[model samples]
Target: HVVTARVVVIIVAAAMVVIATTPVRSMTVVILTVTPVTTLLRGECIELETLGESGGEAFCDRG
Candidate 1:
């Protein structure tokens, strides 16, 4: 009975940890996914700007 109770407690604690961290983990995932895209876009914009293209500002603004 004590072992069963311990097992139940461990399961509950693990579940609670998962539930609590889920949002944070998802946000981290989103940031990780988005950062590279944003960086790539920004790099493209900078390249365009360096090339003295008129559309560079517009492209960066749209991004």
Candidate 2:
């Protein structure tokens, strides 16, 4: 029982460490991935606005 408890504690601690470390990396990856897409979309919206396309106003307003 004692040995099993110790092993369980170690495993839980290791899992906690991995859980803690994983999100920061993933958050950065998400932000990095999302930013370029938003920027590109915004740029496209601006171009559309300049060209006086009908639906361009809606996109720029959303951004």
- Compute each candidate's TM-score over C-alphas: 0.39, 0.44
Residue 60, candidate 1: Cα error in Å is: 1.9
User: Compared with the true structure, what per-residue lDDT tens digits does model 2 show for residues 1-63?
Assistant: 345446546655655566577875756655554576566567677777888877867867977
Off by over 4 Å in 2: 1-28
Clashes of each: 0, 0
User: lDDT of all the models against the reference?
Assistant: 0.64, 0.64
